[model samples]
Every structure is written in C-alpha cells, then in structure tokens.
Target: VVGYELSNGQRVSKDEGIQMAKIGEIAGVAVATRKGNEYLRSLPDENENNNLGNLPSITD
Candidate 1:
C-alpha cells in the first residue's frame, strides 16, 4: 500500500492512489466482462483467500 505523511506528523495509507491503480489494471477486464467475455470472467481470483495483514489497533 502507498502512504503519505500528514502535517501533524502522522502517516496515513493512500487509498485513492491504490484504488486508481487497481481500476486502471482492471479496466479492460471490467469492459470485457460487461461485453459478455466468458474468458475474462473465467479468470481466477488472485486474492480470493488473502488476509488483510495484521489487525490494526483501535487507536490506529
């Protein structure tokens, strides 16, 4: 994940940046899926069983 520092000296994940990248990578697949492309839709889920890393603290 991408990150950035805030003015108060705190770090935050750059969700928008990651989302944009994901969208770009999936754009073609999304279009093909919408156009009833069976091959694209048949692709396996790369992160289907992936975990979200360690859990975050409440204060985080």
Candidate 2:
C-alpha cells in the first residue's frame, strides 16, 4: 500500500484511502437514489420505489 498526503495535509494509508474512496462512492449512490425516489414519489405513480432496484452496487 502506498501512502500519500491528502489536500487536507494529513497523511493517510493506502488502505485508508481506498476505504474513503469506497465510502464516497457509496454516499454518491445513496444521494442519487434519494433524489430519484423523491422525484418519483412526487409523481402519481405506483412504481416509485421500483427504480431503487437499479441502484449501483459497491463491490471489488
């Protein structure tokens, strides 16, 4: 694992960086899902939550 300094001036382990990157990715997907759900809920449809089934998965 390669270590490096982040923009925050903190040294982070490569493993930690990988973990942080994964967390950020998951957060982004969650936000997208939330927004899509909100928009779908506002519409008069019975298929609102169905779109959530297509959310991206976090995996190696």
Candidate 3:
C-alpha cells in the first residue's frame, strides 16, 4: 500500500495521509502500528465491502 486515492479524487502520499488522519482532517480511519511501522487502518464498521483492503487498486 503506497498511498491512497481520496474520495475527492485527489491522491496523497502515505506520509501525507497519515498526517491528515492524525489531525482529524480525515475520517473513518485510525492510525495503527504494525511491526514497528505506522499505517492507517479503517475503523471497524458493519460494511465489509468498504474495507480499505477491498478497495480497487490504483497505479502511479
């Protein structure tokens, strides 16, 4: 997972998205750490189809 395509059709780097999420500029996501690396994770919800991993992939 390199980056994300925002709902507004804008693409941001992973670091930028992390910062946004930290300041509450983004919603429905929480900052998480795995294996000493930080990343964004979707808040648990009833919608399985909306999971971040289930989203369509994009290319640079």
Task: Tell me, by lDDT, which candidate is best.
Answer: 3
Q: List candidate 3 stretches off by more than 4 Å.
A: none
- In terms of lDDT, which candidate is stronger, 2 or 3? 3
Residue-level lDDT tens digits of model 2 in 1-60 = 254344455666645654664566212222223534311112224655534334332322
Candidate 1 residue-wise lDDT, 1-60, digit = tens: 344333355554555323433466322222123354222221244654322232232234
> Which of candidates 1 and 3 is the stronger one according to TM-score?
3
Return model 1's CA RMSD, one decimal: 10.9
Q: What is the TM-score of each candidate against the true structure?
A: 0.24, 0.37, 0.92
Model 3 Cα lDDT, one tens digit per residue, 1-60: 889888898999899999999999888899899998889999899997877888899996
Question: Which candidate achieves the best TM-score against the true structure?
Answer: 3
Q: Which portions of model 1 miss their true places by more than 4 Å? A: 16-60
- Candidate 3 steric clashes: 0
**Pick by TM-score: 2 or 3, better one:** 3
Instruction: Return the lDDT, model 3, position 49.
Output: 84
The regions of model 2 sitting more than 4 angstroms off are 25-60
lDDT per model vs. reference: 0.35, 0.39, 0.90
